[model samples]
Target: MLQKVPKQYLAQTRNIFHCNCKIKIPIEFSEELLERAFEVLEEIDLKYNSYVSGSYFSCINENRGNWTPIDQDCVEMIRMIKKVSLITKGHYDITCMPLLQLWGFYKENNHSLPKKDELATALEKVNFRSIAIEGLNVKIGAEQEIITGSFIKAFAVDKTIAFLKSHGVADAIINAGGSTISSLNDASHTAWKINIPDALSKDVFKTGLQINSQTFSLSGSIDNNLLIDGKKYGHILDCITGYPAENLQTGVLTKSAFLGDVLSTALFTVPATIRDEVIAELKQHFDFDYFIIDNDHKKIVTECFQYLR
Candidate 1:
């Protein structure tokens, strides 16, 4: 099962990454440092949160098809997300809000699977290219909303770590909602230790890593998954098919938390035809490994991926 690093090693806080998050410094921080961390969380939550009806992101979506002024942070964040979408060849789509809504994965969820025609209708509004960004102004296609649930929390953690470093703090780790994770300079050990939970089994991770200066991300739809006639269905939907992806889950490591976050999500859904290209793009930027479990409950291995077992 997933567990936190021992409490003794982390200065903890809640609702920071839409969940509990931590910052571990080699040495302890003063109350001031903790306060600063919370401040960072508030800033990110205000700007990037997609669920809040009045958040900046909401307004951006609410003003779809018009040139909406946005914060500089959104510009950078949008650029980063768009870059990943490009590299993944639409596999990492930011404009999947309508598709998510159809599947009852949006804020106003009905918890019922959508009909085929309903899903096809929803897919009409799902296009990453619909997002138009020109300098500080942004626009989306009518009825389009860019959902950042895939990486906003991860971005927040990355920002928090930068904030801490600016304060002359080093040696820290951040876990965002138990998915996006990042670590800084080493503390007690030569590297940080993390486990990639077994995608095909319960409460187990055959592989764990010792690393520093890297981010790890896991995307799995097992939680809140569908069960029908003793068969299971994950929540991740294929962008092309409007159906649940065949892969049960995917895990990846990279230098950018945002990239790791996007990779895990996209790789879990997209077909193998585009998998190598995305993996190659990642390898060009950082040393990485991946683990993918398909619907057949078989692990797909690659030269770049080594099993811990």
Candidate 2:
């Protein structure tokens, strides 16, 4: 049980399923514990995934007017979705699927920008207000469904960390794709240091995150992208305009990558005029620290980012 060797597995079909992860679970992780961890990760992928047609959100959309109340796990995720939506003033909405599908980020069909009239039409179908949730029961209006599959990475990290800890994984780190979460035991000697890719170049390393304690989540658009009409498009969608984020090149460092990943995506779509206000709001609500990389690739670090170093 005290062995130093670690086991590594690559999931074949999640969003970043193509991206491999090096899991540093303890040797004491029993066969049952390992199976449970895999099952938990798979469930997170299945229940929260947006691309899957049979997923909860997709099921709700298919059943529209019938109205189905999700289980507790979904309720919790929706709660955060609503909270973050309000904090971002609707810029971080989860109901941006219409716009997301129209743009073809998942489909990879690479459609051109929609005409103003077309965009306006799609925008009509996009509204977070259409979703109504009361305790265990959630109802979707005639035209809306909740999609938080993308939102689940951080949640998965949180849930996975909880699972690992419950299974006696005291000193462990779960790196699901680029999202990283870790817990340290008093006896563990090393800090978890993760290196982020450069905002400008993947060939070069940009910065390092060294965590002594606490949960951290991060999302950025340095790598995931497409080029249309000579303009580059990042995977982070603008919930307001329903288009890929183009302004912010990369975002790193946050209190919860769960929120950080969502914010990083939201920040990409936010207008320059309101960024200062957004930053202030983030600092006020979550006590989260951030490091934002602008279009020019300049780094802006919050007060607590020093701890990440």
Candidate 3:
């Protein structure tokens, strides 16, 4: 008699959220299951992707200042985003789309930093408080727009994880764009190992993390930035200042990938002096750990963060 060997299966797609996504399962899974997981991602992209012309988010953006009917899911997503915005004191705002455009982040050829007046003008429209929800309808301040780039991918990953778990997946991992990663039950595979790269050097590994049934979201300015007049400007802008945040990198680990994604981005924009205080306030509502690589290249980590190396 021969011993049975466990089989692994992998699925990958590049169209979701404009980044390469991958899912790996330790146990042999049906192709239909894999396709269904990818379908989850595609549905999210179609509904919430702000760049898509006819997406629900795009519709909301296009009708700013006017109430627009939205699905229950969209209403819930906005509520979650608002809760985080209130907790972060508006540091993490979806209405920062104006600021992104001011910095020419959405355009390929215009990569210059915004002028002071331009930044100030853009700042006027970047307020989370301006977003309103009326039951299944939503509205934003005039000239204000929402961008789901920060957490939509992670939300999709979370949905996929739930879908996989419903099918009895014992061990699985989903990696979204090398930034947001989520895992299902790790009972079969002890933990998933993830590498943290140097902010300036992609080939160098700064540290590694071990996550079990958790999600890790990393926010960094190294690879996504604009170079103008020999000066590099990051894409993650501060909603208050209408300028790029000073933090070079931020990582968050949480049970919910959506929470991790929003927290990582919010932490990146927060000043270092009060970051711990903000984390403390957030911990009151959610359980998570974080690390920050400041502008000075200082590494700060929470006590509970699991390090593999």
Candidate 4:
């Protein structure tokens, strides 16, 4: 006989994307299926993780001036990233690795401020428009580099959610390092409850939000930051300024986890005065809402932003 209550399966691992990833399915599922889902995540990590030696992404960075052959999936992902970059007016760029490295973000215990000349040189190679894609071949300008830290993990989660849905699984939530979360809930489970943390305060949750079959991505200046001489420097850098963005936090909700991840990072760098204009322009191409906390702790949210008390 079928069990009256559904069994929940929760799995977690810290190997993929160098972060703690968790997936919860509140329905009876085979262990093999669960393992396959994690395998999917690992497969993505192996193929495109730039940190991995000889990976596709690393190869592209290695041969910056030469065209490299890429698969269809790579082409699509790059195209999507370019589209968002165009819409955001270069506020979010995958080619900002030069600036990231200049600020010592990619290193441990070696964070240092860059000199004026160093910052200028890094900014010269930070243009996303320089990434050229032709057919199955892609190339970047010389001295240019691409970093997938912003959206690659979320992209993997979206792929896993699609896989789960294909196998008749309905109620599931995948959390990638507490930064990106993608969910699939059926009528049986209407939504997943998520807590929103206060950006200025530690150990404080401001509110709880409910998400249904959507992705929630949060980018904050407080997390994964470096302190140099008592000044906090966040990992999210502004491509134009060649410095860390000043926004405290930005949150985005979208149907695609990839989009959510990219948008959240982009929004964090956008200035508050013109943020509404950027959001309006984005709405024309995508369906999403956002909330941002500025440096002054002022809350800015779109009219369509939904929150549950």
lDDT, residue 265, model 3: 95
Instruction: Give the per-residue lDDT of model 1 (tens digit) for 1-309.
Output: 987665344366566645777666644667678777768877788777887677778888899989988889888878777776677677668788778667665444354567889988988888877788898999999889888778788777778878888887667787766677788864644567877777766478776776587888888876646664566666677767777778877878778786788778878877777777777886675456777877777676654465532
**Tens digits of per-residue lDDT for model 2, 1-309:** 788854442222233433544456556556566656666777766776655677776777777766676788777777766776776677767777677666666675674766788777677777776777777767766766556645666666667668877766676666766644544444554667766666667666656677654555555665667667887777777677666655655344554546656666656566566778877776676655566666765566776565323
User: In terms of TM-score, which candidate is stronger, 1 or 2?
Assistant: 1
Per-residue lDDT, model 2, residue 233, is 78
Provide the TM-score for each candidate, comma-separated.
0.86, 0.84, 0.93, 0.93
Local accuracy of candidate 4 as per-residue lDDT tens digits, 1-309 = 976764556565655898889888644688788889999898888888777778778889999999998888888989988988888778889999888888887687864679999999889989999999999989999999999999889989989999999999898889888789888988887688887778866368978678899999999976688899889988898786888888998899999998899999998988766677878888898888888888887788876454421
Candidate 1 residue spans exceeding 4 A from truth: 1-10, 106-113, 186-189, 228-230, 281-288, 301-305
RMSD of 1: 4.6
Could you tell me the TM-score of candidate 2? 0.84
lDDT of 4: 0.85
Please say which candidate is ahead in lDDT: 1 or 4: 4
lDDT values of the candidates? 0.74, 0.64, 0.85, 0.85
Reference-based lDDT, residue 3, model 4? 64
lDDT of 4 at 224: 80
